[model samples]
Target: MRILRCLKRTPGIGIFSHNKSLIQLKAYIDSDWATCPKTRKSITGFSVYLGESLISWKSKKQQTISRSSSEVEYRALPATTCEIQWITYLLHYLHIQHQQPALLYCDNQVAIQIAHNQVFHE
Candidate 1:
């Protein structure tokens, strides 16, 4: 496969490093509106990191169709939040102190506004 060939050609490297002093969690999320031609479902993708090291990530087709791009991006929040929550609990179990709250970054402005507003919008 092309991926395997690229990996073989590239030199081995160690990039991730542990930093006990700063144990902050962050998640980046995005979604494509109506990417699937057949299902017409948006694909949600997210990556979770701990102190600059990637710890978790996923990309999958949404179970339900989203009418708007903002809706699609909004749907991604729960999954990313759940993953971050699980990681936080895991860190707590291991007695790793994470004082700062996890940050989520999304590209869509409407999605951000939707998340901020408490009132429901159809």
Candidate 2:
């Protein structure tokens, strides 16, 4: 109740906060590997943004177990990718154009290596 009251007083990000003209969509993804002790499944979370505007975000527990933190982080990538694609499609339908490829931000080095094809296996 106290937290809710505090949240109510704070204003959310407006449609156009810092950049008003155009918003280049990007995303950030993270996961807590083996967060659930019983199932050993991870908790995946992602946030989607249009330039500086936060358009969407969610966090949920995954159903599958992962052997490594990188594996769990890798699993989170596809969901984030799907979100980026969907947002891109919506932008296109709205006739908005952005030159940059959707940027993905993450922390796991092994997952980044795999994404760049720098390493075959962990």
Candidate 3:
């Protein structure tokens, strides 16, 4: 079975008052390649949050073997986007003010194209 992992705990705070406002939250996502010894496929994952609170995260293996690193990263986009949408919905439910368009970062160009163009990779 493929596994999806997400980091939930907030970081960067050693000791702070609850009354203090959190200015920002940073999420770092990576994969575990050691688990699948046979396939050696990297396990991809992502995280989402709002101001010092972890709202969402996910880590999972690729459904199919990717020919190259770009393909693996491209496959991870949909999953990441789904998490982002979920976090956005949660923010809306909590009535947190935010900008109209949310900014997403990706190192892969193919993955970005896949998210923007529906006809891509079809």
The residue-level lDDT of candidate 1 at 33 comes to 97
**How well does each candidate superpose onto the true structure, as a TM-score?**
0.82, 0.79, 0.61
lDDT by residue for model 1 over 1-122, one digit each (tens)? 23235546875843355655368998999999999999899999999888877778899999999889989999999899998898888789869787899999999999899999999877
Candidate 2, residues 3-119: lDDT per residue as tens digits?
235446774722455755456788999999999878888999999988887777889998788999999999898889998898888779869789888899989998887887854
Candidates 1 and 3 compared by TM-score, better number: 1
Taken over the whole model, the C-alpha lDDT of each candidate is 0.85, 0.82, 0.58
Query: Which pairs clash (backbone N, Cα, C closer than 3 Å) in model 2?
Result: none
Off by over 4 Å in 3: 1-35, 113-119
Ranking by TM-score: 1, 2, 3
Candidate 1 segments exceeding 4 Å error:
1-15, 18-21
- Kindly indicate the candidate among 1 and 2 with the higher lDDT: 1
Q: Over all chains combined, what TM-score does candidate 2 have?
A: 0.79
Candidate with the greatest TM-score versus the true structure: 1
**Candidate 1: 10-residue stretch with minimal lDDT:** 1-10
Off by over 4 Å in 2: 1-14, 17-22, 118-122
